[model samples]
Target: MTIVATSTSAFYERSRANMKDLRLKAESLQAQVGSGEKLSRSSDDPVAAARLRTLSRLEKLATIDTSNADRASADLSLADSAMSNMSTAIIRAQELATQAASTTLTDDQRAGIATELDEIQKDLLALANSRDSNGHALFGGESSGNAYEFDASGNATYIGTGNSQSLPIGDGQTMDSSMTGPQIFEFTDANGNTTDVMATIKALSEALKGGSTDPTGSANDALASLKSGLDTLSTAQTVVGTRLAWLDTVAERNTNLSELRANEKSDLGGVDMTEAIASLQETLTILQASQASFTKLAGLSLFNNLS
Candidate 1:
């Protein structure tokens, strides 16, 4: 009969390796339970880790999109408010023009109305050249400076060079952040004449100073122009209002999508706390049993007997 001998060093080394393996497994389970993440590295589960990375990138992009949406909404809101003010100013100008159209008013009274109209024109021009939150021209289109500038003839002219500003708020979604100065304030009248509201107001103010042979006829013309100008302002307000409503809808959709992505990410990468805690307890129990068994076997060694 042949007898096989196992070296004491081999037994000790194997026992040490087994204990190390058991301890490592217990520690891993503990980490999963504590941190609420299943895998610490991609090597733990390559496919799941890859999916998690994609989700993380998407989440990061969503955060940026949300910020863009906020900025765009703010810009559009400022534009809407400015347009509303313009509409109110135009309405008040219409009232003044109607009052000046009365033959009962004297030249001095008409001149007084013109002075007020001049002030209103200046206010309207200032509103047209207003700045947004970014300090850029609100209606400047692509231009960085004022949207409207006065020519040598003192006529307010659109100095902007492009369409209104736009921003991407979300996936497949873009919003116009502003409207061009010309689009808001300049429109063709029924007479096929390109009417600039600022210029119309200027004309009305000049006519109110009473130099025409038929003063009442000139006043009536100014009143008609003022009515057309009010219509233009009203149309602009409607456009801005529609855009603002669209932004609200899109912003709500973006928020819902972001929340859905967060939930999906949690399902993909987040740990199941109950399962992890149970696994940790099981691993700890096994580690303790292994340690106790190793201690008992080591005590039975012949080296211990000799000692």
Candidate 2:
């Protein structure tokens, strides 16, 4: 007769696995309470858990990009303020030009006005290469560490990168975080052009201080250029502001998406503490009952030899 085997060890092995599962669940719940997060491990559920991990990393990177954009936006705002000051200086220069145009004014009085305008031009140069939040050049483009320098001839030279630095915000969107000094203050000047608007203004100031009529023509040229420069700066400020606004919208959207992903991740990998605890308690009870039954069975024997 063929007999099938029934092993006492089989029941204990199954019971051991159940006990291990309960212990894991208990620890998982404790971890959730400690971390204030639902999913800490992908082993909870491989598919949904893996996606959550990706989203979490992406969210972190997106936050940093948003911050980068914000800082870039702030630098642009600072540049705009500097440009505003320059605009004021230009207006003052125009007024002085009108005053100097009067035949009644002496050369001495015109010289005083020119002296003040020269100071204004120098201030504008200082503002153009101002630092951003990172102590980097705001208008130095991609090379924030570099600053605009002046040579012995008082010519402005850019020690920065040729390209604008870009930061990725989200969803394949990027923002040009900064502009180089040349883009803002330098221009292609021909024979009559001075190559740099600041230098042109500075030269006009110096020429005017000589009490000579030579600057009258040059000053008119500078005045036109200053107006055009202001228009360009203002337009750039407007564009940067619009991009920041769009980034703000995108950040808001990403925030919502991150939250949703977190919740989905929890749904996928997070064990319900209430249900899990209940299951744990029941498993423990079952284990105790199973152990008692095993003990009782072990103490019994199908055949007792009575010789």
Candidate 3:
């Protein structure tokens, strides 16, 4: 018969190693239960960890897109309101121009109308230079200052950029936040001339105040240009409305994407609390049984039993 001899130290060492491994596994499962996360480190599940990182980056980008969309919506709304007010001012000016074109009006009444028209011009200039949510020029096309600057002669000139700024709202899409001052105010007149609302109003005000050879004739001529300016403003309002609608659509899409990302993140990284707790309990019970068995075996000596 062949007899195999094992050292007591080796037996104890093996028992301790097995118990330590079981303890570590139990602790890991407990951590997952408490933390509600399946991964303690990237090494736990490299593929899932990498995917989680990607999702986190995408969520951050979605947040930025939401901010940009909000800003664009605000600026567009402000532009719409300002344009509506401009249309109102233009309609009032049209009525005054009709009154001034009458031959029955005296020179004094014409002068009064000119003064009112000048006030309206100032109002229009103020609207053109309206500030955006960030306190920058609303219609200045990314310029920091006013859209129009007045000179010594009080004639307004466009000092803003020709094109409005485009902002990214997400999903690889971009939208213009606002329209430039010239876009809403300038149009081709009846004389085949490029003219703006401010210029038309200024010229009429001057003519009504005796700056022209014939006041009634000048008022009659301005009617066509004013009508053109109003039409231009209406077109701009429509454009703004369309952009706002597009933003709403993009917002809804972004919201759905956000929800999808959240669900994916939960599935990839979130721990199932019930399963984790049950596993932890089972591991603890086995660990306890192993520990008690090891203690009992370590205390049992062949020499003591023989004695």
Candidate 4:
């Protein structure tokens, strides 16, 4: 009888271990389904676990790079639009100068065009002071407020700092936070004339209406100056386009890399549901058998056999 009890106790202990294992396996399957991961600990598969950790870190960095790309693209777009507007302003000034050049129009008509140019100048100044989504100057590099400081003499001066702040876009890649006010809207071209579009507009307006006669060569010179301003604006447009295209490539690469990282992470921790189910069923059967055998043996009596 003692032997029978000892054998039964051993069987019971074994059954208990098997049942615990089955419970653990079932829990693991449940976790895999719910959490969408195959392993919860390093003991599950150390190599895969390490790979998953690495991929997760890279994926997070890629996500941040994506955000930077979006912001940079927006800044470039704003600059491009502003440049286009400056070009339109210059074209209008050119037309006005041509009309005023005719010996036919009354001084009143010329003054009228000048008045319109003055309004256009105000509008152009407003554009030069345009802000980005973050409320920073779009053209003034990194200025927080208006980029142009128009003096009492109507001279528009750049009050912004030198370089814009930068955003980290990728591995060893960075984008200028924005173009500075001076870089985009302030400058002197190859000609002695200032290319400050707003300042030019103001000067032309004053020249037209300052009660001066068709100051013989002034209108022609103004047109030439306006053309120079357009050239500067056109060059800026080219730069913006190039930056935007480069950002597009960077954004595409970042997107592809991010997707690759996510895939790698899944591969590292993903489960095979078909295989897991098969293994779980097998473990359940073994545990059931072990429990049944342990129960039967625990009920056996050595006295019966002895008799």
Q: Which candidate ranks first by TM-score, i.e. highest?
A: 3
Model 4 residue 137 distance off true place after TM-score fit, in angstroms: 1.7
> Estimated TM-score per prediction?
0.90, 0.75, 0.92, 0.88
**Looking at candidate 2, what is the lDDT of residue 45?**
60
Query: Across residues 195-302, which tens digit of lDDT does each residue of candidate 4 receive?
Result: 666666676667667545553256776777777677767777887798899999998888788778877776788877777777767777776787787677656675
Better of 2 and 4 by lDDT: 4
Each candidate structure's count of clashing pairs: 0, 0, 0, 5
Ranking by lDDT: 3, 1, 4, 2
lDDT per prediction?
0.82, 0.67, 0.92, 0.75
Kindly indicate the candidate among 1 and 3 with the higher TM-score: 3
Ten contiguous residues minimizing lDDT sum, candidate 1 = 1-10
List where candidate 1 sits over 4 angstroms from the true fold.
1-4, 7-14, 301-307
- Model 1 pairs in collision: none
Candidate 4 lDDT at 264 equals: 79
lDDT of 3: 0.92
- Candidate 4 local accuracy as lDDT? 0.75
| lDDT (tens digit, per residue) of candidate 3 on 49-112 | 9999999999999999999999999999999999999999999999999999998989899999
- For each of the candidates, the C-alpha root-mean-square deviation to the true structure, in angstroms, is 2.5, 4.6, 2.3, 2.7
